[model samples]
Target: MYSEIIRLKELGLNISQIARHLDISRNTVYQYGNLNPDEYNQVLEDMQTRQKKLDHKREKILSWLKEYPDLSGAQVFDWLKERYPEIDISESTVRNYVSYLRKEYDIPKTIHKRDHEAIEDPPQGHQMQVDFGEEKLKNAQGNLVRLWFIAFVLSNSRQKYVEWLDRPFTTEDVIKMHENAFFFYGGRTKEIVYDQDHLILTSENSGDLILTHEFANYTRKRGFLIYMCRKQDPQSKGRIENVVGFVKKNFAKHRTFFNLERLNEDCLAWLERTGNGKKHNTTKKIPAEMFALEKPHLLPVYEKLNSTCKNSITRTVRKDNTIWFMGNRYSVPLGTYDGTEKVVEVMKVQENILVISDLETKQELARHTISLEKGKLVKNNNHGRDRSKGIDKYIETVAVFFNQPSQAKEWLKKIRAQKPRYIRDQLQMLQRSIEDVDVLITEKALNYCLKHNLFSATDFNDAIDYFGKMQPKERITRFGEADFIEIKPLNEMDRSKFETKPMTRDFNYYKEILERGHIC
Candidate 1:
């Protein structure tokens, strides 16, 4: 072919003409034409001869291949370099040589993966695997909201239960969900397996598992065995690993963000419809059907589980909202000093965490670490400077931007109460949101939030932009209909806790908004 191309090129033919005459491609003609006779002869010789410069190591490579069929070419290259440190050969060259030798000797590389056995399931109700998974879902407002979830799978039956949270899981959250899962599955398994999640296990001392103090207390209270699998051992917890992926792919994938309640409802529905209701791909058994056999074997769910704050002591709330604990006055959230609620129950959790709860309601109020010296005010960074009066002032100032100061202030108070930890940031955000927007729009946003019981500053900001995007016709039509388009709470917060005023406003703003789309 090369000779024919050369003859055609010599016969006053261009690459295309030569290609046509020789019945080959133009690239073929160009390729041969680009090299002179000596270079072309060298190329031909190189193509015909398979003797790599590094082919002398064929004996060693073949021996290694016979000894270790699973050895990778790169490993062989490393071995060669180790044996002959002075050998000058590129890794690619060594790889090529190894490839050539393997083909010549008919030795194919085999990968050695761990052998999987068809292990039988544990006795019915003996074990349930636990794991967590998270995904981001877009809400109606087109905001990216991430939700974390923990899933439980019965190893014997492949039965499943799952719960979701809009925030990171605390030990308390985990315990609560575990209780819910127990209720869902009808009973607790003999041993629950889990990944070494920091929420539960603090550290593994030698062979002993050191669980977090709160979790340890719960475990002792509940009386179930915990089997934490080591990191990276997915196979040990394969059942729950599959459940995690199944939840992420089957249930949570591309699902819209609502409240945690709705997400869990959808997940439970899916588990009934497909997750456990479907036949297992591996065992060829339907999980719900299998769970019937497993349910009776499960141990009875513990009755009368105590509040997570076990072994707690009552402490008097000082006038400063600090609680007396071991001679130190640690600050609670600013209104914990209300005369009606004079005391809080304090519990010492792991890592010196102080969990303060309402003495009567037992609802957790604040969590802080014991950091300061005795007699020094150990105010948690979470509870910042006294801002009740200032927050009211800030809310009023932001509300004044809208037409109804009292309504806006009440709505803003809802925001402050709902997001007490982030009140300052939320107020600042509300102020920024109303700064450049139209007053009618801010008022509409505020009313929209109030009407829908949306007490979030973020939601308020979204409401402003939501209204601002509409035409005057859309403004009036959308304003009334917008009340129906409520966003699911980012966290499942109780709106009843917020003191709201009647959504009564003067008709003049709407009368102006009704005019030819102008802010008259």
Candidate 2:
């Protein structure tokens, strides 16, 4: 305090002694050593009420800090600059103001902070790092569309490959992207490094990595080793991490997304020009040129995959549960046939393996080796098996609703024989009609239908309705085992009272309706 300083000075205590007694810095004590109490008090007042450039945005900055306490000064700087571009200021000034706010508000240091150590680059063709990144870009429609990309970078050369998708990545997507990335490099490294991403890993069981099924299969098939970094440890796989950020900031930053195909094509071109063609910031060597020296050391891939080739094609399931592609018929599940032709995705992966899957569920329906000969049927035996099972059980269940179960079953079998493809539909229709009709009327209709050999459900329904609604619910008690319930012919319902006697009118009830304009 200024008063304390003057009191200490009057006591003949030097600046060093005063600083020690007050626990203030010697610099601070010397600066106030010669100033009078009035000047010191004025300085204190100015320090207390000093205005800040970002004071107008204090609330917004505080909320951001409170919500994302781990956000760095640089991130906050970028966010403010992005959202409010008109705000003219330097990053250092924003950082100083942010520090001031943090001290005044008593917020603490962030969590999940980790140490970073520089690592030596792996030898050529020995290692590559892979990771995923996402960004929102303006589409052709000028709407913000979020896109994801899996990035790969060779550790020695910094050669990069990126594949983008409008949707989130899946395990299969990871595999496909890996193939394209390796193909772009002409060969693959012996080992690949990555974060413990869920798409590739199901769990980290202590130290043992359990990969997702598809990714595990793809890894084994490709004969490559994977090293997944520990949780929150980006330092181990920093190459791909930098590549992901570089792709987002450099290539995809302001690029308007037209489509996945166009975006990826542009990305490949960007890599050839700006991404790998220029000198890398750290290595100070062109990545593409380095790749030429490293390519010979890479493990040769079994085949060259053209990234431009479409991954899959949509095929309409035929009525016979077959899809015609490349002049061959491939059978899907039997129930795949529907009133409206259902479509399935057919992906050809690794030679002739046709991976057919449902469009919505993405579950593989069938896998077949494509037939070489045209007009050949590449069928899985299970696919051609009868899809309708337990039909007998369904028939027996329906028969229990009728009084004469045996007769009902026989008639149902006849319907099944007549409509083999639609027996289930027929049985369902028959059961619905039985629910509304009286039992006696149902029996009479069933017997009449059997006698007339009417195997059609529609004809049977007509017979049930035409069985003369003579209080049919009450008519059940009127009929006995010994009594023969006589029913009229199918075409002859008793319409004696219902029928109107034909009266010869001159013309439309004396043309009154026409005069009145009652008929259109």
lDDT of 1 by residue, 1-520 (tens): 8878877777788888888877888877778888888999898888888576876777778898899888877888799889999988888987887788778888888876898887898999899889989899999888999789999999989999988899657667788888888888889988989898766775666659977667788888778899988878999889889889988887877788878788778888988999989999988999999999999999898564645545455566877788776567788887778774375667777657888988557799888787647776777766767557787777778777777788777777777777898988998887787776666687777778878999987788788778877734322222234333444677898888687777887999788778857645
Off by over 4 Å in 2: 1-113, 304-520
- Candidate 2 contains a number of clashing pairs equal to 0
List where candidate 1 sits over 4 angstroms from the true fold.
1-50, 56-94, 106-110, 302-304, 310-520
lDDT of 2: 0.83
lDDT, each prediction: 0.80, 0.83
The per-candidate count of clashes, in order, stands at: 0, 0
TM-score of 1: 0.49
TM-score versus the correct structure, for each prediction: 0.49, 0.42
As a TM-score, model 2 comes out at 0.42
